[model samples]
Target: MADKMLQGKVAVVGAGAKNLGGLISRTLGADGASIVVHYHSASTKTPADETVRAVEASGGKAFAMQGDLTKVEHVVKLFDETIKRYGRLDIAVNTVGKVLKKPFIETTEKDYDEMFAINAKAAYFFIQEAGKRMNEGGKIITILTSLLAAFTGLYSTYAGSKASVEHFTRAAAKEFGPRGISVTSVAPGPMDTPFFYPAESPEAVAYHKSQSMNGKLTDISDIVPIVKFLATDGWWITGQTIFANGGYTTR
Candidate 1:
């Protein structure tokens, strides 16, 4: 691949300050893209700030923007900040998500609503607002989950949230195809992040590991390259969910 495959591009990675989001931001920055690192909270500096540091360290340009993605106004503000700082918006990777774990019966309306607000509704508007500012050949990628297909117990709301994102990718791709913007989702299973620590329980941990073909956990680093690929190289592909789950799905 060319060293500058993403040169001169501007990207916004929401929730970019910690864990997988931070890693994805750094990887894209390393590939020569200028970045807008978006975080949700104000109390603490987000992982996106650290991402900016890493990007500058690697000789790329980046700055930090903060907003609540759950609200349309804030989502719009995120992009506005990006454009104000960078002059253009080219790629928006929606990596903001939360999982509310409980059995379907125990799940509350509030849980469903909150998950949808952050995981689904946020991405939809993020793309909408960013799309308005994005130039030709722009890209939008969202982090999805194999759980939507696996539909395991204890994640009814979570799975529904991700399933919404998967379908949104398809719809957005079609809606934006004429303008040359690509929309896609990358779904992974059993990733090694702070999000997966319930696996510390011996029985549940064993079961989770067993689901992988290799009986191992997928590292955050393992997923960054694929996220980078979908954001840049796989331009012709859109509306599809590429599962990066260590062979967690064979069908």
Candidate 2:
């Protein structure tokens, strides 16, 4: 069997300034991969720098990059800088997303466009650029929401936008397979992040916790190992959305 260790590999983590993305970057860096930590906004720069510092402190090489991934040029620049700095790309993980809990009736065109731009369009270009830049045996993972599997309402734009990533994962897996690249998505349940709290009510948060095991929301810790696996030994499992939501929702 091929060794799955990440030592000496190069990884680009999109939205890697904090939360799940931050953890993934640090985890992989600890395992010996050089990291390109990409943050989306100026406010995220500190966290991005912190993540890079953690990586370097772990004895791995790292640096921070900033870009609005909704723009293809920015996406291109992201990968371009990764290759320019690292000399090779081995893993790409995208955690860029925006959530909206408005009713479909109340959702404006702007809301829908912005949701798709961040969740769908950005994801597509990320995969496209990664495929172009990555060497053989590379891995690409995207963060999606388990809401994609739920039979519910009130998240029409949120869920609907993320749903598009499944197909992108499938197609990328097929196209990139011959080159020894693996593509996949990880869908976490209602995570206990600021990102989730803003869009959810207290009642909805409680309900989400009840549906998962241990009566708690998914933590960033819960999802990172699964992503790390996909980037390493779990390479054989591609073209699928793996739900790591503690049984919050399943197909």
Candidate 3:
């Protein structure tokens, strides 16, 4: 088998300033990969800087960049800057996503467009750009949601938009396979992040927790190792969505 260790590899982590993204950056850095940490909002700059510091502390080179990845230009610049700074790209992991839990009837056209833009469009371009710029044998992963497997409602837009990424993963994997690039998506269950609370009510949160093992939500810690695995040891897995939702939902 090809060596799967991350040592000497270069990685670009989208939305990598905080939460799950931050942890993934730090973990990969600890494993000896240079990092390009991408954050979106101005508010995320501090976290991005902190993540870069953490990577550097781990003896891996790293720097922070900001971009609204829903824009293709920004996505292009993100990979371009990674190449400029590091000279090569071996892994790209996109943790960019948006969540909305509204009834189908209540979802506006604007909401649908925005959700698809952030969840689907951004992911597509990220993969496309990574495939264009990465070295042979690179790995690409996108963060998705476990809701894609649930027989539920109230998240029509959020889940539907994320659902599109599964197909993108498959197509990209096929097209990029000949180049030795592996493409995959990860669907983590309802995680305990600020990102999960805004759209959830108390009771709904409780219900989500009840469905998972230990009657608790997924943690950022729980998911990062899975991502790290994909980027390294799990390189054999491609063209599929691995649900790491603590048994909360599955196909």
Candidate 4:
């Protein structure tokens, strides 16, 4: 891809205030895409501002919007606001997820509902709204966990909820292919972020590192290029969940 492959495009990054989401937002913005950096709450507003400033400093355009995407209305508003701000949507990336490491029997009703709400329901609606609002030949990407490919204990709800998005991506790919839209998911192995460490024990972290080819957890840097690729030059690869966990897990 060229240096500014995403130049003149517009992207909506869910949970774009910090961490992997923040990195993706900044990367896309730096690549010349006008970014709609969607943060989940007021606590992250400052980071959202920083992300926007970072993009602008890099010679790109961006603005931050706050919303709870678990509610379908908020998901709709995100895209609507993106179009309102940027006039069009060319790419949508959702990195919103929650992790839990409890046995199935120990999980509560509230836990299951919350997991599915953000991981599955929010994902489905995000894609739906994006499809409805995006310009032709747009890209839709979701960040998932490598546990989707693992026969692991615990994480029953975390993995199970994210598991639904693989199928959602597949179906969305076909349904939206006629419009030149590409929908795909990226599943990384025990990523090196706050999102990963809290749910893991010290021993579990060691085990995750052992499984990867480089004996390290996946980094946000490791995945940003993949998302950028799918959003630009790699647009042809649709409906597939790219397992980007080094050798951690594969199907």
Candidate 5:
């Protein structure tokens, strides 16, 4: 217990039932933080339950909750419930996002709205709720994409929607600074996750693999350590998007 980096802390992990989010929830819980694992749909509830069980099985505390984070009220409830259960929030990591890879001309209004709603809008309000509910010195992290730094096509909506969160992170960092809350985003390259594979074609995948080191896609494992650092020891690093893409994209 004395060695746990986040002993006695509490965290609200958005979309924390699977993939990178699930790993984060488990990692934070292992570090001794009580966790609120949030999932978006009924289909994900089982994974949410599994995550909660895994967390507790690791000798940490955690529970599962459901919400459509695109709704501000749901986002609020996420934090509210975290406090209700754990009585404090020391960290929040929002891994909520939707990706699209369609020709700009073929993209529709519905496509753009859905992308922005899940990627940008949800990220914005997640930060808002975290800011309001977290105790002093808390941290907030959003998952962005390294495509934000790429001169690529077919990802206009996905990249565009995530672009908004960088600004939100910067502003929130400044506004939350006085309260000792650090806000930041982590941009990983095309990750080796189900969330990524469906959006990419074989040719696109090969090309993405070529640009990064090791001829491989980013792993959720690679990104999780950075998130952990930001939530704990990396407190001074705020208001910036750290690209953890293995040289996939820079600047």
Candidate 6:
């Protein structure tokens, strides 16, 4: 087994069913931190079960917790449950987001509202609630999108949502600095996950691949190290979003 990087620590990962969240859960769990697998209804699947099993097998601890991050009460309840079970929250990594794939002309007010509710609003409230309950030296990592910088057309709403989270991450970091809580965001490029392939067009996918220095989608394996570093070893790092793209647009 690997060294216990975060032995006896507790981490709550929002949207930790599969893909990025699952990977984050497993990575932290493997490092010796107990995990809270928070998932939304749409993400309900065996991924949660599988993640819990994987964590336990790796000499870590984990439990599955479901809640709608869009609601403030749910966010409070989630932290409450985590503290009740694990005693205190040492880390929190939020990987939940609302992605709207509609064209600009097709976008509506409802779409804007829903997107913010999930991406910005929920994240905002989650940080608010979690920040209040977190102990000193706690870590908070939020997952945003590199699209905020690229602004690839046809994703106005999606970009806006991610941009908001990026801003929130920075602002929260500054606010939580005095408390010894570090807030950071992970802005990843196109990753080889269900969230990327199903929603993107062939042309778009090819275009993104061509933009990369390696000409490929971001691998979940490659992302694990960045997450692990920020979640555990990055005590001095805060208020910055680390881009985990495979040389996709240096900007």
TM-score of each: 0.93, 0.98, 0.98, 0.97, 0.97, 0.94
Q: Which pairs clash in the backbone of model 6?
A: none
Q: Write candidate 3's Cα lDDT for 210-250 as tens digits.
A: 99889999999999999999998898999999999889998
Candidate 6 — worst ten consecutive residues by lDDT sum?
1-10
Give lDDT tens digits, candidate 6, residues 139-191.
88888887877846777888788788777888989999898888888888888
Taking all chains together, the TM-score of candidate 6 against the true structure is: 0.94
> TM-score: which is higher, 2 or 4?
2
Give per-residue CA lDDT, model 5, range 1-251, as digits (tens).
01225999998899999999999999999989999999998999999999999999999999999999999999988888888888888999999988898999999999999999999999999999899987888899999999999998899999999999999999999999998889999999989989988978899889999998899999999999999999888888999999999999998
Model 4 misplacement above 4 A: 1-4
What CA root-mean-square deviation does each model show from the true structure? 2.3, 0.8, 0.8, 1.8, 2.1, 2.7
lDDT of every predicted structure (CA atoms): 0.82, 0.94, 0.94, 0.92, 0.92, 0.85
- For candidate 1, report its TM-score: 0.93
- The Cα RMSD of model 6 versus the native structure comes to 2.7
lDDT of 1 by residue, 180-208 (tens): 88888988887888877752466777777
| Predicted structure 2: lDDT | 0.94
Cα lDDT tens digits, model 2, 1-251, are 44578999999999998999999999999999999999998999999999999999999999999999999999999999988888999999999999999887999999999999999999999999999998989999999999998999999988998999999999999999998899999999989888999988889889999998899999999999999999999999989999988899999
Lowest summed-lDDT stretch of 10 residues in model 2?
1-10
Model 5 ranges off by over 4 Å: 1-4
Question: Residue 50: error of model 4 in Å?
Answer: 0.7
Residue 147 Cα positional deviation in candidate 5, in Å, after optimal superposition:
0.5
* Clash totals for all candidate models: 4, 0, 0, 0, 0, 0
Cα lDDT for residue 137, candidate 4: 88
- lDDT (C-alpha) at residue 60 in model 5: 98
